[model samples]
Target: MTTITRILILMLIAVVSPIGAQDFQGIATYKTHRDFDIKMDSTKMNDAMQKQMMEMMKKQFQKTYLLTFDRSSSVYKQEIELSKPQVGGGFQVSFGSSGSDVFYKNVKHKTYVDQKETMGKKFLIKDSIAPIQWQLQSDTKHIGEYICFKATYTKQVPKVNLNFNSKPNIGDENEEEKEPEMEERIITAWYTPQIPVSNGPAKYQGLPGLILEIHDGKLTVICSKIVINPEEKVGIEVPTKGKEVSQTEYDDIMENKTKEMMERYAPSRGSKDGAIQISIGG
Candidate 1:
């Protein structure tokens, strides 16, 4: 065929293809898991005790989330589990924040509302996605059936605390405050242009195409299944039945609540009352 004939055929295909990525709607299910590198001094507990603790931590970190998105907006939330009876009520530690967060994002508008539930209290956190300067690399890989590109960025993150014995004073105005230590966290994401829209799990977005996998060293969320333009369209709604708060305000609320819990249980620290306490990270 002549060169002119090939050019005309390409133009015709473009006219027939879908014009907008947002027009295609689907749900992507992701399964998340975390890794813990803990050096437990080795002398404090025997090998058997350490193994048991690891098993419990694994159960707590494994979670599943579903992201339902159309061309412009998407809603991502966790799959809740049925309530089960606990064997023993004691100190339990989770790798991530102890909250079930529901994120609603409009990709075109660049806005989001996070419906966060912490300690049975609801918070509607309205905020925009933070602009991340990702350094796009030439490396390409496939996440599922779609081909994805690589990007990386670094941010300063607060050091996580899972202390079960911290005692914090409530409403103490004269108490001197100490700044919490911060560390640099590197985030990497893989996105596919084949999917078209810019969306991902959690607070990640602004990529050329939809993000298929993302990781922040400790935890990773990978797309396990994707259904495109199903028979029934998933409803994307902003959560309203929660106390309205900005992202900063929500963090403050969580911090204060955590302090209250630590002080409430401070007296039980190291007490040999035949109670069980399990902690994962140092």
Candidate 2:
């Protein structure tokens, strides 16, 4: 059948079928993966070492998240797992979002509360949800048992500079610094109307249905399983712990911290023995 015909049939079924309880709630499990390629100086690092590093990076990027939602509110959080010891080289790198952070969204109020911890400090980021202008498409696909419709949004995001070198750059002192570049990216989401809830993993929502899959840049989030109305009702609580701050304030704090780290670990001039250079592409 055509996509339009399929949608019509689903709408008919929904009209004829008996409606469930009014207090709708569900738990969705999502698996996330990012595709990245790392390049390092061949002279400093051997093929075996690079291979080991790639394996470690892969483990870091592969993570799972759980979203518990009622009718108007939802809580999305990463699944906590035991940290494994870093092997291979003596160098260890830890980056990206923390596993303990919690994201809470209230679609009815158009607000979000993100509880995050960084630099041994906890912050509760409270802010209004930035509206996304989604262009709903007629394309349809089946994700597991649910038929999903496609939606897309375009936005400009900061371009990532992944070149890292343990060698200081020697440039003219009179040269002016350039502003950070921005690039446009299209975010694609596949939502299932069967769920009939405006909830999704992370900060993405505002859809007519629950999002089953998302393609944001190089990262992909796919719902692996969903349980609707379990025996024990899930409680959605607003986080109270941490110093409250706006989303912009939290972003500024993180940016300053990152700059500090870069300055501290930046390589000195005339360094050769332990110099390491890495470039990443996605």
Candidate 3:
């Protein structure tokens, strides 16, 4: 059967289902993995050092997150874990502070509030949820015990320059630098009607059912486990501890910060660079 037909059936089932307590909550565990390729100056980094860097990057990007949701609202955050310090060549590799941010979404109101921390400053990013025009596909699959249907959406995102060569080109200083071009990216999601909740990990929502898996660029988020109406009820609270800013303002700040960081770490002309450079692409 087509996904749209299944969705209609699920909606009918939900309408006729018995109404219990007003408080209905669920907790979903999601594991995320991102693939990255690191290009470094071979002279500064040997085979062993490169392998170690790759391993560290893998560990850094492989993370688990928990989504606590009700009928109208949800909160998504990373599950923290303690690990031994990773240091190489007098530099320490650490996870981004944004990982600890709390992302709260209200599907009923089409709003989102994200608590973000960057450069020792806190910001509350409040904005309307950007709607995704998903095209439901006829393909179906199984995620654990749940049957999932495929849906896809295309978006334009800033293109990331993955050219990690630190060397300067001749006459490159005279050329005017252009803004990063936008590229089309397809996001694929697998959602199950069995759960009957319009929620997902991170900032993804608005689907007919709970999103069990998502493929966006190099990152993949998959639901590991789900508990419905657990013994402990989930409470989602809006974050209010940061300076308020719109999502676009936050993006501008981050983009400038990234440019500053790149300039700071960029190799100086005619200098012996011993630092390791790692680039994580989305």
Candidate 4:
């Protein structure tokens, strides 16, 4: 490294005051970008329409979020945007994607309480950060000013929906659909020891350093900026506004609610390709 570059890094370090082995609090801004691909028989729609739909879905998932953290507690939530809802295409189905909930985590206590207000009902999901068991590798890359190392892991998640007036599966209203079979997904993360905190964009942590970038192949979540101990004190407060319930209990509640909506809407009538297929608790 050149002497001038080393001096520049030192100056930058002094300005940011990166967290080390102690209690620290700050805010991190992240921008998440995702690509959406619908698997439908192309015979129904032309190539232009398909491309336009894909682009719209991609923009819907793209969002910015803020994560505030201390030594133990951290809260992650998405930034609000002013935009008109996408309409006219019919099929108003919600899929399994990243949410805009205030995810509060207590790392030292190994507990988390997320606050979510969905469909006029509030939920507080108190649970542990399900273990990921990441395999740390020697690969490294520079993300902005931070030197980050890569780690990968895999886990099973519930089957997701991308219903674009695609199927006539009455099974959606059936009880069996509630027990969605798990599908394994691979996750890649890049962390930097420069910011010595076990924190990341979403529910990812447990690494030796702070994760600057994370991806699950389909979606990419990366940090846009890191402000360490800014002029304003970062309030790392635990959210206690929603009705308390365990993670499993909350899932059951959502499933029951979704089933109720499916039945009410009469999914059998949703045969038209452009008709709205309502998905409750989406």
Candidate 5:
């Protein structure tokens, strides 16, 4: 071929090659609903105290979740909040925190590095695992003006417990002996293919589309708004210095925190008079 023709072909390839890369970007939302089946061990408490404690626990706990996702290459964010607030005499307590997670996908190396932030700190965890082992059904849908795809993957996420801070002080010395609680959860996601990005709101991705919605068996998160391919660039990265622990350890930490709080605030949580002096400062 002539030198001029070869040069022209090379330029053409350079201009159009990214399209062949099949890179698209879009956004989706997920909603989750959590249900707790808590049973107290009456064997551990006096009949009266058992009833009282069970009632107290039932009253204190409501479903909650940790929402985390990646914003860009190596950057992630998370929010932990109560799915439902406890209310009974026109009062409420709020427990919610926001954080982040990291994202790194080395397509060339076929490796993924995922990181997350908790309470303003960062932790890294395994991103590559058995490929979800899920069977899903998909349908095309629209979110606002965007043509998106929706899918439902009905499967159990086995129970997951995250023990962040576990320290025990008193009450129900044998509470640790009780069978560890397991949460059975289901997740549903809605996404868009228009953006062509294989990333979703959180650790969920690699689907046929960008997730616009996520629904767990207990809670639901809907992406009320989305902006794709903005003029600005976003960067996400992996976390460092986070103590590596199993999910059980995380759950233990959480449970320990719950126990500590209950003990410290027992008077308020247990007394009817304290209940009467409640305020839900919305």
Candidate 6:
């Protein structure tokens, strides 16, 4: 063959078979840790007139979540943990995905206490559930060499409508007029696609990369390390529950019980045990 013909053939091969394809089946790792101050919204609390200076203390609440993704099969596995003190607690959930459908198993642990109240008997318990619907929210962006993406996701929490029994009642059937205190924490997550997994620790997922950090205002959960695409297939199991109840009913029960407990435990007229007490009618 002529020299020109040889050059043309080589050019044709180069054009057809591109060199160095993207690594769509490799593992990615990420880790980050930071501190945050926690407090209730001033707008939600009563007694706005008396501005109380809240102190900032170091609260140790950390978590570790492990994730494994297989891009070839589109399946992912996650293990989450909650590490905290006696007053506060943590929970864990395991989830995996096959195609568009996802499956989950959740386990949560908390300090348990039972007592009687005006509303009824109540229990303070902890539980966790997993494998909710999660989708990719955005494309990957580069933060230095590492690609990242900010994706917003949601978890449908049960309605929490708890009445405040600690407040004074005007009359019978007048409870509706009084204002109740409650708030629904709508959670959103930012993930990175560098990991290429649809699974995240707790209820966080659906970003272009691993979730380095997440906050629901009150408590913040961050990823310390993420190991992606392990060679062996990981098994995710649904955890056994110590206390089982739907998300909606659980909040409702807690609210009523807390209010009743406050009323009974707190000093009403002139006792220091209550959250607020006033000496009157002496």
TM-score per model over all chains = 0.80, 0.88, 0.88, 0.79, 0.52, 0.44
Task: Kindly list the per-residue Cα lDDT of model 5 for residues 218-261, writing each as its tens digit.
Answer: 45556655545435544433455566654456555556655555
Deviation in angstroms for 70 in model 3?
0.2
Rank list by TM-score: 2, 3, 1, 4, 5, 6
Candidate 6 has a TM-score of 0.44
User: What is model 5's C-alpha RMSD?
Assistant: 11.5
Better of 4 and 5 by TM-score: 4
Candidate 6 Cα lDDT to native: 0.37
lDDT minimum window of 10 residues, candidate 2: 273-282
CA lDDT, every model vs. true structure = 0.73, 0.80, 0.79, 0.73, 0.45, 0.37
Model 5 segments more than 4 A misplaced:
1-92, 99-130, 157-170, 174-176, 180-185, 240-248, 268-282
Count clashing pairs, candidate 6: 8
Pairs that collide in candidate 6 are: 191-209, 192-208, 192-209, 192-210, 193-208, 193-209, 266-274, 267-274
2-106: candidate 1 lDDT, tens digit per residue = 546534543554445344443678899988888865545354446665666666777677778899987788999988876444453343545324336778999
- Model 1 has an lDDT value of 0.73
Model 6, residue 87: displacement in angstroms?
15
Number of clashing residue pairs in every model? 1, 0, 0, 0, 53, 8
Q: What tens digits encode model 3's per-residue C-alpha lDDT throughout 1-282? A: 765687686677556544245668889999998887657767666788777777887778788899998888999988988877655464445554656689999999999998977776898999999888998887888898777878899999888655455453434578787777999999999997776677798888878788999999989999999888889786799988799999899888877776667677676768775655544311
- Which segments of candidate 6 are over 4 A away from where they belong? 1-146, 153-173, 177-188, 207-210, 229-235, 273-282
